[model samples]
Target: MEYPTIEQLHTKLINKEITVADLVAEYVDRAKASDLNAFREIFADTDIAAQVAVAEAMFQQGTATVLTGMPIALKDNILFGGHVVSGSSKMLEHYTASYDATVVAKMKEAGAVIIGRTNMDEFAMGSSTENSAYGPTKNPHDTSKVPGGSSGGSAAAVAAGLCVAAFGSDTGGSIRQPAAFTGIVGLLPTYGSVSRHGLMAMGSSLDVIGPMTHTVGDAKIFYDAFKGKDSYDGTSQEQSIAVSLKKKLAMPKFDKGGIDPEVLSNFEMIVEGLKKEGFTIDEIELPHFADALAVYYILMPAEVSSNLARLDGIRYGDRAESVSINDVYGDTRGALFGPETRRRILVGTYVLSHGYYDAYYNKAVALRATIRKELEQALETYDAILTPTTPTPAFGIGEKVNDPVSMYLSDLFTVPANIAHHPALSVPSGKSAAGLPVGVQFIGARFGEETLFALGKIVEDIR
Candidate 1:
């Protein structure tokens, strides 16, 4: 009854030790037990049964891929044609995607099975999953604590062993922060490395899709399956440069070892373990990192305001039945949006207003350029930058929910990578004194996924 990873499950299928139907049934049961409020919707048994049938046929024909019949959870924002794509908001609760996202399409081509949609922050705006319309997803480590967000459900599902792996979007650390809280590996690819075609826009330039799994190797496998150029996404670049750069970069040295007392000790232990394995550890500082959260809030909300402008109820979402068009637009948005969404929308509007555009929005854009330049310079000397994924582990479910600023600060460490357009990964380093998981982040230059995978492997091995 043990849950196997994607790789292990593939081997089991090949050896006939477990059938696809049996594997699917095991996950279904685990999901049912933990429930965890992780899934907003679990796929119907009939749908899973049909997928297992195809997997069984593929196995018999010796055509199964590594992901054949593998169950994967999805953050609700990513479209999966015919499935609801609510982005964890009440605004589009009944809306279904007419087509699959580029990442989803690739997952299907690799023969992965979509188990269900997981919960998240409304429109991917908050750091805690509490902003979800359904409810916050609880941390598997401690049910009273949050799992992190807006990709909290994806991380929680993986940590709770509900699925082999899950797909999560990262814009200001949605995926990495949650993975840290839940004791798993979360990968955020270099911006534009993965196609953003069907993902609901939060901050368009900052969002990137990545994988969350229990191990680094699984992260690599999933990233390989979906990364590369996609015609539908003009931003996706060819993988040739990324592949070549990965081969050239040296693995990072785990120096500058101090972290929080508990996190510091664990990080030191991991470094020593890696040193014995012959990997060099180096200490480097990224000064602009301190200003990342401020920069992120200013830039992300400005973009959110613009991207969400299309949702005025006149476009694709639910419309208010009102006598006037103005009332229809105003009432629908006011009714559907959560506090965080409204806050960002207001901030966005303020920054973009005629009198303030040059002072606020323009200033933030200039700071973004500086941050990006600083990160690029740092990567020239260090293969990757290392840090704690979060300032602390998962807190109480509603602990910081009402305090928007405090919630935004939770993403402080992870947001710098997004602002810099660099790839980052969060791997479980150890546990906090409270027994909650502690994660360490590895950030690399553009197209630096290979470095992340290499460093991630080294860290995970030591941990």
Candidate 2:
């Protein structure tokens, strides 16, 4: 049985053309076949069976929701009750979540089956999935190349058709970059659009949970279900109630300056295709966009260092039994954290160190504020800012492992969205010369996801 999209599968369920059990079984089999090292653990058959039964019941009662019976992969950082929620780190490998994250509960209510936990960069630190304790998830398009990380597994699972869609967290382009590499659509909602109650803290101020799917329409379906206010998360805000996709259709066009020529050409073709279908286009610019990456690195590592400090062995997480408390903390962290994790911790610690705080961390914060202001001003003139998801396609494994700075640069085109707390999506633009996927991103203002989705759909139709 070939993989059917979420829309097709949902239509079949509504029409009684396929049973929930049969659909799940087919996806489970495909997941087993590809494996791809995408998942750290697949849900037990009993779990899937129970969920399918619920979906079937919902259908029978004419109470089906937007995602009824759809199988969806989750990044290990997002907690699901009674499931191991290791953030791809050895420290919490045996930790099982005792409660469902608010997002997980929302997904279940919408009728999505929690398929399995996908692998990721350990503690969501690395740019490549190689840092995962379970090993790197191979890209479905080219096994030798990376799937991009720390949301690599989530992207790979969706691209490989193991699941119609998946959830991934982005602190700094983890969702969008991988989606670009895999030829899928990935969204990063506004900073507080989706509740973060159940997601493990990497960089608390920056982490966001979003959907990755085969199409913009599918992403919007999942987004609508999980976004909005939640009592469990104080940071979550009510969505802009008056906003509609209709308003987004009137957005002006934008030029692709400072982007790769090939990427620009592909984007033009997408624009042309959309214009033929009655969509509008205009040229706009976001000044200070080029400095987004520098600001991100400065802010993210500082936040990461602070958040990860809670993982000291004596605290709530995994601990090492040997030596004194200090030794225990050192040994446990040294043993549990991947090299990338340790590097960030060190960089973060230095940035926040007594005398350097004003020079490093504080400076970075000032830059962050400036960048946010620049983005806000840009959005006043343009509905969305567009760019290629990554400067280049996926590269081979070990190609960037030794050079941390080079790996960080891979997210050059993606960091600005995170910096501004704006919504962004990576939609498939086309395949590269090597037959690898390429993604073009659409960025919008804070709480401007409807605009991103509206424009994303236009691109989706063209692609």
Candidate 3:
């Protein structure tokens, strides 16, 4: 049987149909039995029981928060105080967090039972979870295929019924692609809407933490709990901007060879379904949308190169012993970081270098602004912009891992929202003939998540 969503679980707790302890225990066992290897660590049985007891008391006192007694699995990149918070990288393999990330603190305050830490690509760097230092996470639906990453494990955990809902970080398509691959809902909130205080930095400007869940409502529950201003993160803002759904949305003016045939077919079905439900479907032109993937690659890697400089042997991560201090730096990084990470760092450094800065990094930034404006203009006329969450369903593990260009192409459809700093939600559209899941995205204007949720519910019913 499938696990109930947060809303259903809440009702069950109130009616004494299931105890909080029972629910947590059930999920913990479910995780252990899975062959997908979705978790890096499942909290100790004793530790989980103690949390369960606290939630049980919340039920008894009638003081339960929306997520009280509910089990949640966090992407490995999110910090949990006193736990090993590796970003699935050997560099930080033994490093432990001393404080909770803003999101982690909020989850605890709301009485969420954090069951474990899920795996991810090393330093949140790849389209597929294959970059994980430990091992690649397999898709829950088909073990031969990959679960999209760097949030693949969180996506798989939720898909396999191991958790009611889970948290995943989105830097490019990490969360949404995996969610699509696994047949769940993945939401990427507008930049600065959620705190970034304790998250292990990737592309600091592009990275965001959001929910992976079974339904639009379930994702909304978690999104509401975490968003707002945080004293610890200057980028976070308490957004009070209000948006109303227009019952209208826009789609890109397709370029030849833009998307996979299967995905295009499912998207057409989604458009027709929405039109039948009284939605105004328009093909709005965002001319700069064509350049988003390139823009993201330039900007994201530039940020990644800058942010990752801190992982030197001195401050944190595993250190290498060397005669010269400078050699220690080279030795530690050379031995610990993965190939994909090393590739991005090199690209980032090249673009940010003195001679190339104006030619590359500056241009990406200028174009990013233009792209954001294009999305802004579209939103004035439509509730959201729609696209396939990924070009194709999850590919077989090792299929694209050896080809970097092909791997990057997996993120083509999902990079625009990150580049534009807009919010996007991925909901399962339908499945392929081979039974693989496919997802469609709804991109909203800045701080316009509610509009996406409203339309997302309609998409869910149609699917």
TM-score versus the correct structure, for each prediction: 0.94, 0.93, 0.98
Q: In model 2, which runs have C-alpha deviations exceeding 4 angstroms?
A: 1-3, 241-261, 271-287
Candidate 3's residue-wise lDDT over 118-160, tens digit each?
9899999998889999999989889999999989999999999
TM-score of 3: 0.98
Model 1 clash pairs are: 253-280, 253-281, 254-281
lDDT of 2 by residue, 23-110 (tens): 8887778888885898888899999999988888989999998698998888999999988999999889888998999989988887
**Evaluated with TM-score, which candidate comes out highest?**
3
Candidate 1 at 242: error in angstroms?
7.2
Point out the higher-scoring one by TM-score: 2 or 3.
3
Give the TM-score ranking, best first: 3, 1, 2
Cα-based RMSD of the predictions, in order? 2.9, 2.8, 1.1
Q: Which stretches of candidate 1 lie over 4 Å from their true place?
A: 1-3, 240-260, 275-282
Error of 3 at 284 (Å): 2.4
lDDT of 1 by residue, 352-373 (tens): 8999999888888888888899
Ranking by lDDT: 3, 1, 2
| Residue 286, model 1, lDDT | 56
